[model samples]
Target chain A: MNIFNYELKINLKSSLYYLLGMIALTSLYLTFFPSFSKDTSAFINLLEGFPPEFQNAFGIDLKNILSIMGFYAFILFYILLISSIQGMNLGVSILSKEERDKTADFLMTKPVTRSKILISKLGASITIVLITNLLFYLVSYMSINLIIEDTFSFKVFTLLHLSVFLVEMIFLSIGFFIGVFLKKVKSTISISLAVVFSFFAIGAFAVNASDDKMRYLTPFKYFDTNYILKNGTYELSYLVVGIVLIILCLVGSYFIYVNKDIDSV
Target chain B: MASNIIEMKNLTKYYGKARGIIDITFNIKEGEIFGFIGPNGAGKSTTIRTLLNLIHPTSGESTIFGLDTTKYPAKIAEEVGYIPSEIFYYDNMKVKELLKYSASFYKKDSKKRMAELVDIMELDVNRKIRDLSLGNKKKVSIIQGLMHEPRLVILDEPTSGLDPLMQQRFFDLIMEENKKGTTVLFSSHILNEVQKISTRVGIVKEGKLIKLEDMNTLREKTYKRVLIESSTPIDDNYFNIKGTKDFKTVDDKLSFLYSGDINLLTNKLSTLKVHDLLIEDPDLEDIFMHYYVREE
Candidate 1:
């Protein structure tokens, strides 16, 4: 348990700079918007003049263009991008990093089982993902409160943020699974990026193309911001699917990492 | 009592269809320094990997400290310290952090052990492992392997990157560990180092244990280079003596490898009034070459 905490501490310390950088970027984009005032006719006319395909690509509905909820939808893309990057970086590097660094032999030489070592690393990685998402949520919430109108429901806001976290966890676990299959660090990073961005692309295309049934194919589509905003609730089916995928990926990662042949120091 | 600290009974490993190691059998007594000496691609690393359960053997059985390697690898790992040929550490981690993380597995007093090892290996605990030289990284690896005070220590090419001074220090460290009843099994291509430390040595060749014996016995049984100066030119037929190979002939002098009964050759030479005779004991490298050439 102490070892798990130590591992977590090390991960958190290493991730702090990246977390701060993401938050800084998020805050800069949210606070320094080119058009901030809601009553400007110029902004309203510009929104009206945008193509429907462009609006759909950005998850902007026709009715909610001038509303604070719509702005939240625009910022959500950046949030998902940042969260996925963090998740993948943390997840893919956790166990395989030992192998990449040639430190597996040094670690294995100790009086511990492979299962225990793996569990500790997994625990640390999950904690990093959770902490990063939570930090992003908190920063975004504060920014939204200060910059956007008060009409935004805290409950719906929480649901949207929680959905983003779930999607991140799913992607993170997938990255963890990739780490077991890929040994080289560069390959692990490339594969992780490819996987996360590919899912994002699929979900974006499915939503923009108005293919409701196929939206379930991509995890990002599972968190429907407009549905959550309108109904004041998350989709149960999507939540369940996300949870199941996360569990499967995590279990698969553990099985593969434990049995894989590791070169020692 | 545990019969052997380490044992392998006809162990074999295959990487796909290629044999990694084949029919290797040996045992190391408790607290003895056992040397695994071999040339490149001779299966030394494969055999060590099998013993540590890093890779599963295709056939045969291995045990460390009386526990089956495959069946109870975690248990065996708990008692054995392993230093692999190549050492790599997480780039983001400092040396201290790396060592701490490594020591966490053993469920021991890691802090004290880490401090002691840092002092012994003269390592900079604060530097990130990526920034350290290969020798320093090897020192860090040595510290990690020894910190837990395991019952058995297994090192592959343990002194490859170290300077002569550090290598001597490492030898001293191994000696100290052996004195405290820790069994040491090390593989090296450097025959002199093996000869200095190993109570018994196993010579591996082409994935086979070509020779296994006490160091003294191996030294005694190895061939001697015989140089002869004949009163008259010796017959070329004399070169056909058993165990004589790589025979070279000059005007009145002859040179050949001699591994068999020396008395018969000397007696045969005495009839021609031997002018001068010189015999030199073969070193481990010579013995190794002899076996390889003979096999070919």
Candidate 2:
């Protein structure tokens, strides 16, 4: 309990910052929707000028761009990118900071198992992500109503938010695994940016028409906002794959961290 | 006759073929201040870390307080306080908070002891750890380690950052703790620091325990640095005796470390046409240098 509390306390301030950033970014984007809807046709006509492949790669769906949920999903693509970077940064830095700061000797010498330490840190990261997401959901949901008069389906709007949470979890677990497997992480932000951006880039640029299997390679494509907004539910196949990846990364991280030797600084 | 508090039987660790500690076996008895002496990278930290289960042993086994070290590290850690050579804490935290966090790990209430240690070390608990100087950080490490009041304390080169006055106080504190039945494992390359408090000493070289001796017996062996300036060149066998080694004649001056009887050495020195003679008790440095050189 002390370990969990200590971990949570230390990580609390940054989490609040992420929450504020999410609320501010989404609220600011939502305010522009009223004027943008007045010029919807002009915007759609300009988007249609680009080839279909370019639209598909960039997740620009013309059919739903005018609707509030559709526009929300469109904005979600950018939000997801930022959320993942936050998740990955939190994951890697939380566990690796002990070794990076050369405080492993102090913590590892305490009367607690390594599993306890890992779990406490994991709990802290999950709590931070959950709190950020919950507050984000409330503020953004209100903004959609406050900024635009269009009646958005509460269910589809919800499915979109749930998808973001799942994708963030997958990234967080992968970050934790990398943090444990690598002996040292020199710069958490650079590594997070490099990894998150590569996956984001892959999702943006690499859409092979013949083989749709490429979607499995990048977490960004796991939840198609178009599919969620239309079908009112997550695609079962990709959802299962995301959950499996999370479990595997977390389990592997646990086993590796438990047995790893903490050498002197 | 004290029972062994820590027993290592042929413990070994290899970091993927780079030697860490090799077949090192020794025992530290209860209520003993056992000094682990070695130069840097000579496996002192490796041996201590293995015992603490910071690194798993590649082979062999060790028991602390009659429990297997690897199998029961958390349990062993409950009654152990370790002051690492380098002190690192959460830089953002104030000294008081970090100390509280460290104390919360053990089942025992340590608030009283924590305050006592802070007072003795003259540490200001209000200061943030990042703002502290290197020596002040050392003080924090000491206070945190001892506040829990563990049965055993393991320190690896613990006094490097401390000034002489603080070092004396630290030793006094350890001695005070020792009087109350705490066993201490003090590892340092500095011989004088170890000589100040250790009841027994273990000399480690490369990856093995070279020698383990009682402090008094080790000192009583009386290794003297005997240097004689002879008027004429001395024969190699002229001072041949049971405990004379590194016998070298450099430019008509015979020098060797003699551990034999003082009277025998004096009689031999009187027979020689010595221009000057000097026999002094060898410092711990010379004694260790002799051991290290002899091993090579």
Candidate 3:
């Protein structure tokens, strides 16, 4: 319990920064929605001029371009990118920072078990991600209400928010797996950015190709916001796959961390 | 029948193909300060870490307080305090916060001991760890290791960055702990530090325990340097006797190392007109060299 509390306290400040950064970014984009909706037809006409491949790559849907949900989904593509970066950065840095800072000897020599150490760190990361997503949902919801006077389906907005959380979970587990397997991560942010961006790039290519199998490769395509907006639920196949992947990564991380030797610096 | 506090039987560790420690076996009795001495990369830290369960042994096993080390590291660690050669802590935390965090591991309340140690070590608890100098950081490590008042304390080259005055104070602290029946296993390459307090010592070289003996026995059994000034020129074979080695004659003087009876040497000197004579105990470096050369 002490390890858990210590880890949580150490992670709290950075997590607050991530939460504020996400809120500020989402609010900045939300304020532009009211002005953009007035010129919806003009914006749709401009989007139509672009090639189909470019439109698919950027997740632009021409048929639903006039609705608020469509605009939210379009902006959400970038939101997912930023959220995944935060999750990956947190996961990788949480475990690897001890070794990078050469404090493993101090921590490992304690009376706590290795499994406890890994679990405490994992719990801290999960808590931070959950808190960030909750604040993001509340802030985005309030901003959306402030913008328009008409009614919007609360269910559709909720499904879209759940998709963001799902994608972030996949990225966070991947980052954690990398940290456990790599032993020492010198530049955590750079490695995390590279990995998150590569997945985003691959998701873009999958969009252009429109291949069903390619969707399995990138976490971004797991919960399609367009599908969520229309069907009002996540795809079962992708959701199952995402859950299995997270479980595997987390279990593997604990196993490797417990058995690994901590060499003196 | 007193039990051994620590027992390692044929313990060996290999980092892939490279040797870490091999076929090492020794036991430290309770309430004794056993010194582990070796040069750089000679596997002093490797043996200590293996006992601490920081690194898994490739073969064999070690026991602390009669419990398997690898299987029950946390249980063993509850009563053990380890101070490494290089000290590191969370840079974002203040000294008091770090110490408090370290104390939270054990089930005991170390508030009083922590305060006492802080005063004795002359540590400023309010300063952040990143703002501390190396020696000051070492002082923090000492306080953290001893604040819990553990039954066993293991230190690897613990006096590297400390000044002479601090080193003396640290030795006094360890002596105080040992007097309270705490077992100490101290590792270092410097012979003087170990010689000052150790009851028994194990010398390692090339990943093997080459010698283990009581400090007094080791000092008494090793060779002694003998120098003699004769009034007249002496024959080269005049002092030729058993246990006399490295014999050299310069002018009317003769000097050599002797490991045999001192009375026998004095008997030989009485036969000659000895102007002056000096027999001195050899330093630890000479003893270490003799062991290495003899092993080769």
Candidate 4:
């Protein structure tokens, strides 16, 4: 419990900063919505002038560019990219910092099992993601309602925001697993940025745009906003894939971390 | 009978293909300060890390407090305090906050003991960890290690960054804890420092335990560092005899470490026309060299 509380205390400040950054970004993007909605066709024609791949790359949906929820969905792409970075940074740093800083000997020699330490760190991460998602949901909901007058589907809006949290979970798990597997991590942000950008790029250039199987490749493509708008629910297979990926990453991390030799040399 | 507090049976570790420790076996008594002595890269840290369960042995069994270290490290750690050679803590944390976090690991209320250690170490608790010097960080490690008042304290080259005055105070503090029946495992490469504290000593070389002897017996052994200035340059092999090692000659001065019968050494020395002679007990460096030269 002490370990859990200590980890939470350390992570709390940075996570709040991430939340504030997201809120600021969402507000800034939504302010432009009132004016952007005025001339949707002109903007859509401007975007339509680009190649199909380019349009897909930027997540420009011509059909729903006028509605407030659709505009928010476009904004969610950037949020997903940013929060994934935040999640990856948190996961990588929380577990690997002790080794990076050469403090593993101090913490490992204490009267706590390795499993307990890992669990405490994992729990703190979950709590951070949970708190961030909740506050983000509340903030986005109120701000969107206040900024735009056009009626939009509440369910689709909720699902769009929910996808951000889901993607963050997968990235966090991947970061955690990488944290345990690597012997030395010189900089957490470098690893986080490198990984998140790679996935973002993979999702940007879809191998087969029509193929559902390609969605499993990158977490960024898992929840299609177009699909969410049309069906009002997530792709079940992608949700299962995300959960399974998270479990595999975390469980693999646990086993490797427990038996790992914390070599000082 | 003083039951063994730590026991190892053929403990060996290999980092991939490189050797860490090889067939090292020894026991530390319940209340004795066991000095683990060896040169750098000689597996002193490896052995200590195995005992602390920081690394698993490649093959072997070790028990601390009569509990299997691999299976019951947490239980063993409850009564053990360890100060690593390299001290590190959260960079953003204040000294007081880090110490309190460390104190929270144990079940005991260490507030009073923490206060006393802070006073004795003369540490400024308000200082951030990143702002402190190496010596100050070491003081933090010492205080945190002892705050819980654990039964067995293991120190690995703990005096490197400490000043002479602080080192003396640290030894005095360890002795005080020893008087209260806290067993200590002090590991160092320096001979005199370990000699000053350890009741028994174990010497390791090339990942192997070469010798384990009582501190008094090891001190009282026949080993002596002999230095002589001869009137004329003597033959190089003239002093070579049983249990003599590291023989070297510079101009007319001859030096060697001898652990043979004192009478034989004296009888040979009487034949030499010596201008100046000095015989002193061998320090750990010379003694370690003596063991290394003998086995090959």
The most accurate candidate by TM-score is 4
Please give, for residues A178-256, the per-residue lDDT of candidate 1 as tens digits. 7777665655667667878888788768877755877789887888888887898878888888899999988998788
Residue B142 of model 3, lDDT score: 96
Native contact recovery (fnat) for each candidate is: 0.61, 0.82, 0.76, 0.76
Candidate 2's residue-wise lDDT over B1-296, tens digit each? 99988999999999998998888899999999999997788899999899888899999999999999998899999999999898999999999999999998999999999999999999999999999999999999998889988999999999989999999999999999999999999999887688889999998878988899888977666578889998866889988987888787788888899888878887877777889988876665777778556655
Q: Could you report the DockQ of all the candidates, in the order they appear?
A: 0.49, 0.81, 0.67, 0.76
Comparison by TM-score, 3 against 4, better one: 4
Model 1: iRMSD? 2.5
Report the C-alpha lDDT of model 1 over B19-100, residue by residue, as the tens digit.
7889998888898899999887889998988787777888999888788987788777766777767777777789887887
Q: What is the fnat of candidate 4?
A: 0.76
After superposing candidate 3 on the true structure, give the runs of residues whose Cα lies further than 4 Å from its correct spot: B221-286, B292-296
Question: How does model 4 score by TM-score?
Answer: 0.93
Question: Residues A29-75, candidate 3, lDDT per residue (tens digit)?
Answer: 77777776888778778888999989988989886555778778887
Candidate topping lDDT: 4
Model 4 agreement with the true structure over B129-227: per-residue lDDT tens digits: 999999999999999999999989999999989999999999999999999999999999988899888999998989999888888987665478899
Any residue pairs clashing in model 1, and if so which? A101-B88, A101-B89, A102-B88, A105-A264, A265-B84
Q: Which stretches of candidate 1 lie over 4 Å from their true place?
A: A2-6, A25-37, B91-97, B110-128, B224-244, B248-296
Arrange candidates, best TM-score first. Answer: 4, 2, 3, 1
Per-model TM against the reference: 0.85, 0.92, 0.91, 0.93
- Cα lDDT of candidate 1 equals 0.78
